[model samples]
Target: MVAQQHGRRGAAFAAVTMAGAVAGVVATTGCSGEVGATADDRPAGGPRVVREAADVLLASGSSKARTSMEMAAGGTRVTIRGEGGYNFAERIGRLKVVLPRDPAGASEHRPITELVAPAALYMKNRGAGVPADKWVRVDATTLEDGNLVTGGATDPLAAAELLRAARNVTFVGSQDLAGTRVWHYRGVTDIGEAAKVASPFARGALNAAAKGFAKDVVPFDAYLDDEGRLRKVRHRFSYLNQGRTVDVASTTLLYAFGSAVSVQLPPAADIFAGKIGT
Candidate 1:
């Protein structure tokens, strides 16, 4: 992720500028009966099960998603929340993101609607002098973090796809999350490795992220249901800010599988082409 600019400016505009600046597959070979085994039933170890998360979500179709991005900078921490839905099969998602209030508490920011698609991110109500009705588009690969942390909310599908690079994974145990039983797993992942195996739509951006972040290693925690579907995921990301490392924790939750998710990208005419304000 590009270094986020920090100042008295509200988090909304800072996020917009940080964003405007820059910016999975599986194989199974085995006996016919073994092929039917769920991830939990596989004996290859935790990493195998966790690595298959993206494919599981894709097979599940669509789902309702909730995202939270927490950033710590200059001795202050703020959290951004988002609610929306994602079409895993189509690799597109829409999120309504609510930025934190100004540090002085003088004003509340309007919610920004974000569209996450292949190689591009679109935002409405992005502020920073753009018209409310116009969308600002940024190429995902251009972002240092690949839009992972820059947009204030991680893309739902990207979060899952990141698990494709899971390594040193260990089964943390089982727990109930929101009334659903899930198996927990913890480990670290490599962005470059993930990009190599990620789906065509996500490969380019992850590849960019691999070279952009200060470090390629990302620690993560993941939870999955009995059917091998991803229930929740959390990633810890770090990037350089003014020569100091800033930490960002991004979490994504999935539910209501098969939910109808419709995301239509804005037409070219509706995308703001003028310079974005800082």
Candidate 2:
């Protein structure tokens, strides 16, 4: 199935999904008093507790991630199968995408890789006219000038923002996921509220990508490790697709903590920094 390919926003989701599996995100600054994780002095559940654990996890070194997203009701089944990891302290990461063969045609599947930093984003086999074995370098500053997500939010880092804006956090029961013990938490969030909060990666650099997403509260279930880091996340939500609400169910699994994730800028001679359309 053909997916509504979002541009920079898609990249942003890729990053945050990686982050959710890797590091996590900053705290919710706007609703500081209203939303915050519990201090070590007190134990609490909900958004605050989950946020703190997420923050700790996100701040850690590196992690291995497995992510998959599907649009409910015959939507496209998204797969991100590879060794994706990041270094939150350094603000850099890489993703090796091993896509499955297209069901419509007997085409070979090629793995695509990406290296993302605070300043630029690099990708392989992204768009037409891109040179072979070359990484497309797009300035993070100019990404929002174009239609990254048609009739959607521009914030490339929407996932981080969405996590920060999550509310009504409550502690659910515990369970074993992927052979790991985890604490489950549930919450609702106004995905767009992150636009108001400042982030080194997001902030003013985004448009309202959340506009097309269904305004009704979207709920998510997050599994946290003993260290309070997010180990797995599953959410069922819908966003407006071509003026119609399309349900999207996504699951992200994170493991291999403290793995070495080193990302460096590619050779300038082999880079393509231009308008990217995929």
lDDT of 1 by residue, 168-247 (tens): 99776766667676778889999999999998889988987787677889999887887888888989887765456666
- For candidate 2, the lDDT comes to 0.51
**Residue 223 lDDT, candidate 2, scale 0-100:** 68
Give lDDT per model, in order. 0.75, 0.51
lDDT of 2 by residue, 1-278 (tens): 01123354344333222221111121112211112234552245546656554356557767766555443323334333444776665666676655444545476445657665644556677555566777766554444322122111111123334466678887666666666666777887654564455364654333343443455456777767677777766655555433556555555566788988777778877776554443
- Kindly report which residue pairs in candidate 1 clash with one another: 1-144, 1-145, 22-142, 22-143, 23-139, 23-142, 23-143, 24-198, 24-199
Alpha carbon lDDT at 68, candidate 1: 84
Worst 10 residues of 1 by lDDT: 22-31
What TM-score would you give candidate 2 relative to the actual structure? 0.69
Regions of candidate 1 where Cα sits further than 4 Å from its true position = 1-45
The total of clashing pairs for model 2 equals 10
Distance from true location, Cα of 255 in model 2, Å:
1.2
Angstrom error of the Cα, residue 90, model 1: value is: 1.1
